[model samples]
Target: MKRKILAAVFLTVTATSAFTGTDLILAAEKTEETAVQKPDMEGIDTENTKIGISIYQFEDTFMTLYRTELVRYLTEELGFKEENILIEDGKNDQDRQTEQVEGFIEDQADVMILNLVHASAAPQITELCSEEGIPVVYINRQPDSLEMERWEQEGIQAAYIGADARQSGIFQGEEIAVTENQGDINGDGEVSYIMIQGEPENIDTQYRTAYSVKALEEAGVETRELLAQTGDWSQSQGQKIMEEALDEFGNDIEVVFCNNDAMALGALEAIREADRTVGEDIYLTGVDALEEAVQSVVDGEFTGTVFNDYFSQSYGAAELAVKFLKGEETEPVTLIDYIKVTQENAEEILELVNS
Candidate 1:
């Protein structure tokens, strides 16, 4: 249909965020360093090597910032023209994402990166792309291990580039666990808490929800869960959940664990509205050390957050895609690190992000 020399390339940014610091960082490293063996295809390359990307939703605040950084990364590497970069918003719809994938294949893109609306559907997508010889790089929402295994077994040129979500959870939990009160507010040995989760289906949500509480208990505090429900990563949902939880549990709720900064901010708002003071009456924590969240940690309104380092993750994903296009053997998976953001390093991290 469309005149082409080489084939398609797909680069996915799962950045609903994806980095790091701290001695707590854990990475599953895959080493790939070799010479580029240029393909003999007619399409050697061009300045406008079409790059297609599909993100879960544009409304995600962290992903917005992440995609901005990703664009800078790809532009630097590909000199990609504005028109050559096509970004489709799945808007949390699976069918919309499926349609977008079909369109990308029809257009015969050079590369694509996907942040899937449903990571479980990755196998079907991968099979479809492999048939057309398109390499996929999945970012934020990671597919199942079995799906990844299939890709590896079939030698499908697909790679998953993101940080370990479990690390973020562990960091968030450990941050709260180390707090002065240790999440035990009422002089009772129990750490009573509410969990404001992101999407229930997302692995990040599951890990953060479980690990935050696990960390508290591991640090020798007896934990009592008052409530744990999905907030779907929305500020309003988080606020509503916190308000209801406060009303229900009253002074018994010692800590609030939001899976991300948006929910943490929402919980903070509810705490202030209810006239309960943070760092005094209750404690709160979240993942994604967004600017406001970091500032809150500094201001003593929040316990802390896990710094989701978008810069390094996006850079690695984009860098790998370029290597793949140049016919270089690239790692099938790239794992980055996550940092715990607290008053100790909040200022430094804020400056780092701003810089």
Candidate 2:
């Protein structure tokens, strides 16, 4: 088992690590005032305004929190009627989600907040909604950039509200790179990692899988992939993948990067079962800064996780829907910043998540 030698050096690097090659466009900062105040709905009929929300999967820990907050904000804060807001779970099936969206269209929903089951289906979904003149606010799962470009070029009434997946990936890599040995636990001159990703077709999975390694490389650390597998954002799948990776790679696996915390928690179980202690022999990083994951970081079980900022994201989505309803202009793309969570800030984040 190997441990980081200089904790101070690691802390310094973690604090100073910055995003490279892209300007941070934070919608949270832009909507700070609106997030607190209710959207002005002078002539808008709150009780009669029908809202349709379709989550990719209700089982997703992060989106579960997001949908809850989104509904709460729309009703309690924005004065919309609870009965008018209809939410459906897509069950991670694209065809099922398409049917649900069609139903929303048939019901003549005033606005739809969509967490797409397949982001690649954006064009089809957009066409269905646009033909009916239903404004859409897409949340969480981001569509392809080209689709967003079409939204702008054609002046479509759609907007995407989510954090940049690249930032989350960068944070994950920075967490491992800031380790005293840059996650080269066995002094092998390379960080050998197992990547536990979410759905393969999801943009989050793609960006996180690629940019995590990109961040390590940018930090001047050599990296080798011991194994990579999709957990489909399921904890059990994460555990099974980690277990198999451990069996094959053993001590050579210096780090495990999970696209989200549910998988990281599952991976942690696998690591413990193998009697391999994290932050000693191997380090782990994940995204979404889930409550349990944050507590794990505080307890020194995880290297770090990124705060997905569901509060800002959900609120932003709702705000955009309100904007569309009011015939106000909205940017086609809205981005929130993902915050890095480590021992230094884990307790604070845990409290935030709990609240």
User: Which model scores highest in TM-score?
Assistant: 2
Off by over 4 Å in 2: 1-35
lDDT of 1 by residue, 172-237 (tens): 778777877787878787888889999988988988888777777778888888899889999899
lDDT per residue, candidate 2, 122-226, as tens digits? 999999999999999999988899999999999999999887899889889999999989999999788888999998888899999999999999999999998
Task: In angstroms, give how far residue 40 of model 1 lies from its true place.
Answer: 18
Q: Which residue pairs of candidate 2 clash? A: none
TM-score of 1: 0.87
Model 2 — TM-score against the truth? 0.90
Shift of residue 21 alpha carbon in model 2, Å? 21
